[model samples]
Target: MILYIKYMVSLRCKMMVEQELKNIGLHYVVVELGSVEILEDITLEQREALKRNLLKSGLELLDDKRSILIEKIKNVIVEMIHYQDELPKTNYSDYIAEKLGYDYTYISNIFSEVKGINIQQFIIHHKIEKVKELLLYGDLNLTEISYKLHYSSVAHLSNQFKKVTGLTPTFYKKLRRKRDDNLENI
Candidate 1:
């Protein structure tokens, strides 16, 4: 059985999910960002138990199909922007459509309807959040940060950063304070 989870974003989340499965004597074949596959079918009682346990730990077992699909979209974007070292050369819309096995129009429409924001805005929000993270790490220069985030140039990155943050990247970095939207909220 494949179970879609909410807020399974980090490595720690993966570990917690694995532990929960083990504690409940469920054998999982795989656990990857927002979803898991188990070796055996789960009973309703077991499913409820899992859901309750997850909720207690600030996680959720997604039941609604639309919510599941939305999480899948979020997972794909999160992996691309925050985890992956490189993005595809093709446009993000094409890449996302291909990766999700859905038409770009459908995905975009559904995402917008459910999230109350367009896909492009969501991507920009994530990209800016990533820039904040990279800046906080204090390892990459602005030029390198722009390249890593697939921005056209440092000027473009700075402009977007300022637009979203109301401060230049340099000033934001210098302040060493966090100012960005939460991933789950976005």
Candidate 2:
């Protein structure tokens, strides 16, 4: 049996889900970012119990098809932006469509409807967050960070960073503060 989960966004989240499955006496064949596959079938009662337990830990058991698709989209974006070391050369729309095996138009429309923001905005938000992280680490200059993030130029990166964050990249980096949003909330 396969189970989709919402808000299972981090390695710690994966561990928590695995622990919960064990606590519930369920044998899972695999547990990934936002879903799990169990060895045996689960009854509705077991599903409900699992849902409650997961809720206690700030996770959600997804049952609806649309919601499951949304979660899959979130997982793909999160993995691409935060977990992967490098961004792909291709456009994000094409990458997401190919990865999810869905039409780009369909995915875009659904994402906008459900998320109240377009996928482009989501990508930009994540990119800015990534910039903040790199800045905080203090390991790279603006030019280096722009190159690493595939930005066209340092000027462009600085402009966008200031537009979204209301501060120049240099000033923002100097603050040495963390400003990030929850993946689930994104």
Candidate 3:
């Protein structure tokens, strides 16, 4: 059986869910962001206990269809922007609509209604975050970062980065370098 989880977005959350399953004496084949696959069927007692345990960690076991769909949307964006090595070449709306098998308009409306921000804005937020991470790592230049994230150009990436963070990517890199150097001196 496959179970959906709410607020299980990060690697740490996946670990926590795995531990909870072990504690509950349930064996899961896989634990991933927003969902888990169990090898054996679960009992009501196990499900209730797992729900309560997950709640203690600020996570939730989802039950409703709308909630499940919302989590799926978030998971897709998170996986695409953060985990994938390269952003998809296709437009995000097309990618998302294809992935979820729902009309773009339908899910976009639901996501905006529940998340209070449109999905495109959410994608931009995550892409900017990825750019920051790459800048700090010192592995990719602005142009390369922009290409990896599928921005039109380095200038476009810098503009969006500045608008979201109030700091140019160059400035952000400098600040991180200074901070790291200061830590090393102490």
**Winner by lDDT:** 3
Superior candidate under TM-score, 1 versus 3: 3
lDDT, candidate 3, residue 61?
Answer: 97
Q: Residue-wise lDDT of candidate 1 within 1-186, one digit each (tens)?
A: 899999999989999999999988899999999999999999898899999999999999999999999999999998888888887788999989998899999999999999999988899989999999988875898999999888999999999999999999999876764344444356
List ranges where model 3 is wrong by over 4 Å.
none
TM-score computed on alpha carbons, candidate 3: 0.94
**lDDT values, one for every candidate:** 0.91, 0.89, 0.93
lDDT (tens digit, per residue) of candidate 3 on 70-144: 999999999999888777888999999999999999999999999899998998998899999899885889988
Please identify model 1 stretches exceeding 4 Å from their true place.
177-186
Kindly report which residue pairs in candidate 3 clash with one another: none
Of 2 and 3, which scores higher on lDDT?
A: 3
TM-score of 2: 0.90
Candidate closer to the true structure by TM-score (higher is better), 2 or 3: 3
Error of 2 at 41 (Å): 1.3
Error of 3 at 80 (Å): 0.6
Ten-residue region with minimum lDDT total, candidate 2:
175-184
Clashing pairs in 1: none
Better of 1 and 2 by TM-score: 1
